[model samples]
Target: MSPLNSTFFINDDIVHPDFFFISGLAGIPHTNYYYIFLGFVYAVTVLGNTFVMFMIYSDHCLHSPKYIVVFNLALSDLCGSTAVIPQVIDTFLFKSHLISFEACLTNMYFVLGFLTMQSFTLTLLSYDRCVAICFPLRYNDLVTHKSILLIIAILWMIAGMAILIAVMFISTLSFCKSTVVNSYFCDHGPIYLMACNDNTPSAVIRWTHPVLILWLPVPFITGTYICIARALLKIAASERLKAMKTCTSHLILVSVFYFPLCFTFALASIIHRNARIINLSLSTVMPPMLNPIIYSLKTEEFTESIKKLYRRTMIHITVRKK
Candidate 1:
């Protein structure tokens, strides 16, 4: 049987129930290697994102609105990684592929919610950079801490509501078809596809949701950066360099986070479903792991703060030993 069509059968006489089986990285050979590798990735993702949050919280110099936004992104990454990876580890390593109906829907809600929040957060970061670079004098006046917090509150509220609506729609569907999910995690597409009832709602959500969450912010972010680039041309060469430096880390993050998603969506029709699912899983885990590394390496401010934190930690450790 094809991997995509693979299903678990307890016995010919037994009936399948409501629980779904997550077929993680199907058709991949040497799954033990993948299990070990994914465990390492999850560990790094947790440690990296936690370190970013710690550095931002402990250091006052990194308390600017820009870094505050980064802190939020790190938190989202940490949450997203936590929500998806452990269950995936259980599914793949422990062979606990079966997940209850309610648990699957709950996982889908949080994973999708965090994914949407990350996209919106990136857009906010882009806007923040645009304001800092384009309207240097007005940045402090325009994007104050209060305003940023308000925006963040609104973003979270919107994300939560949107995902909740999607989940409610999914809950209404009767999943009478096979409960085998052709993915490593509980994603909307695979889960909804398994429903035997009319999939019009899922199809509608699949089509329209991306427009609102993904395409909408993309053009805005692109236009904002274009404006930033134009503004850079009008400034002094030194000022231009500094402005670009401020944006470099965010630019890298945007590329890393969005490119895979775009590629996955674009090539979804051509690629095998198993491959697509694997790609989606990698995209989900990779950004969380890479975000902190990009920020630590590219942003001089964060790098310096991290170095100071390291030295202080080492000193404390030595003092304790003595």
Candidate 2:
């Protein structure tokens, strides 16, 4: 029987529900406050990512290869937040916990896809820093805005396809046992756990998602930083400090984005399911809201760019007042 099409697996006893019940943060106390907080987070995430994208577009100085990755990261952050937060608010905060099967799958696509893209985008930034620091002489030739854009386009496809495949496999699972998805949203793990039929492929894909999204990128980024460290040794002390300082934001971003997620995944077996859900939700919402803030505050170019944009806006407003 084909796993992509569950028709062959179907029997009179097999059952599929039109909708799934999202048991949001069950057994967690005072969850409404948390959702309210997430609403605030959503607002910040939207504003921050939008501002970063606008600055990257308006400032010619930010039109470089590195900011291309920044732009992509902001874009992913925006979309990823939109994918996960609003539905979470609606589902749990407002008590709209019933999600149609199709909507559930759609949620899986975006929540997971943008997540995949977000991770890959960070790795892309590491590459940018890697090339710039380790291959200083050929940095211009090695990395360009055009090449970065192309890679981003390709990555979007890869992340999308990877998640799409997983969602497809999920669609084929017969939810004969239970339709209660114990998550804030349509989590791949929880959803597949509800399946009654052969979930071997689903199980493999479950691991595959983290492997591609987290495990692989972590090591690759580590290696790049190692190379960066080695290269730093040969440079003048003054230049070395400046180069290392430039990497601060990326390092901070990687730590914030990856560490909590890695921790949550690592302790999934030991922690309460509700705790895991909260951690995953926080890991999702926090990074997007923080990414633009970190980049603007940490990176010198972005700080100047924001000041320039602010000055221009104020000048434009003052001129209109006349």
Candidate 3:
């Protein structure tokens, strides 16, 4: 049998449900311009996050809790972006949905896993900030390096297991070609649609997991930040200003990273539709591209760091010229 029409290896008894979005997308003309646009996005995500990572590692001035959290977030952004961009670029360049069943599950596993890690890490950072600003006396005890490392370990472990559960369930699914995916990536939504058997369990995990992954943490993180802000407003003026300024960049970063993600994941089931896949892809990639810029450029310290680096480079060039 041709791969597209072949029977499932697991069970030849069932047929995969036809995903309407993939069906519709298969009819549209393939275009290279979109690939070019996505390439730019991938470049930004990689370079921007890498720059932040470099800044944190090289600058002794940034060796603090806030910058550490920022560094961790940059790491997460880099991992998450890298996990998806390779396959995404391949899809756009080749215009082929011929990803093997194993490859699809692996891609889904990492993409989902890194994204979950990002969300929880952001939440942890928010809590760290809240404790630092609102309970300075206890902040040192609460957000020590040991504590941060331990939490990071937990985040990775939880994300891995959560995604493993989902991917294991998906790996068992049988997709008989009909492999046209609507989005530029092999997201679980589109992959589920290509399956030849009943994908109801996969669908449930795919659609429901995002709630715990993305939404559940938002209110807790942002809410604590808001509470801390309110508490700051009532403190001594100098200390209050210092605390607020310290956390300002963090708060903004939290908002930018989580808000769009919450909105997008809330519409997970809807995203599998042809009418929504383009927008969903835009939403998914745009955050990774924008996250480093929003955090680094908007923060006073990061900008100053950049200016200092630039000035040092200029001085070095002048010395060479002499």
290-311 per-residue lDDT for model 2 (tens digits): 9999998999999999899889
**Best candidate according to lDDT:** 2
Off by over 4 Å in 2: 1-14
- The global Cα lDDT (0 to 1) of model 3 is 0.72
Scanning candidate 3 in windows of ten residues, the lowest lDDT window is 16-25
Give all TM-scores, in the order shown.
Answer: 0.91, 0.94, 0.83
Candidate 3 on 1-322: residue-level lDDT in tens?
A: 2334533344555333232122323444554676688888899999999999898788788777767777888888888888876666665465444666556667778888877877887788778878887888888787887778777888789888988888877666766566555555567776776676778888898766677666678778768977897988889999888777767776776666666666665675565465465555665567777878887767788888888899999999999999
In order, the Cα lDDT scores of the candidates are 0.84, 0.90, 0.72
Candidate 1 on 1-322: residue-level lDDT in tens? 3323334333343323457788857567777787777789889989999989989999999888888899999999999988988888888788787787679889999998999888889999999999988888899998988999999999999999988888887776665447777788877887777766677888788776677566888898899999999999998999899888989998999988888988998899999887887788888889999999999999999989989988998999999999
Off by over 4 Å in 1: 1-17, 314-322
In candidate 2, the residue pairs with backbone N, CA or C atoms under 3 Å apart (3 or more residues apart, or in different chains) clash, namely: none
Q: Rank all candidate structures by their lDDT, best first, as comma-separated numbers.
A: 2, 1, 3
lDDT at position 176, candidate 2: 64
Candidate 2 lDDT for residue 118: 93
Number of backbone collisions per candidate: 0, 0, 3
Model 3, C-alpha of 257: deviation from truth (Å):
2.8
Tell me the lDDT of model 1 at 127: 91
* CA shift of 270, model 1, Å: 0.7
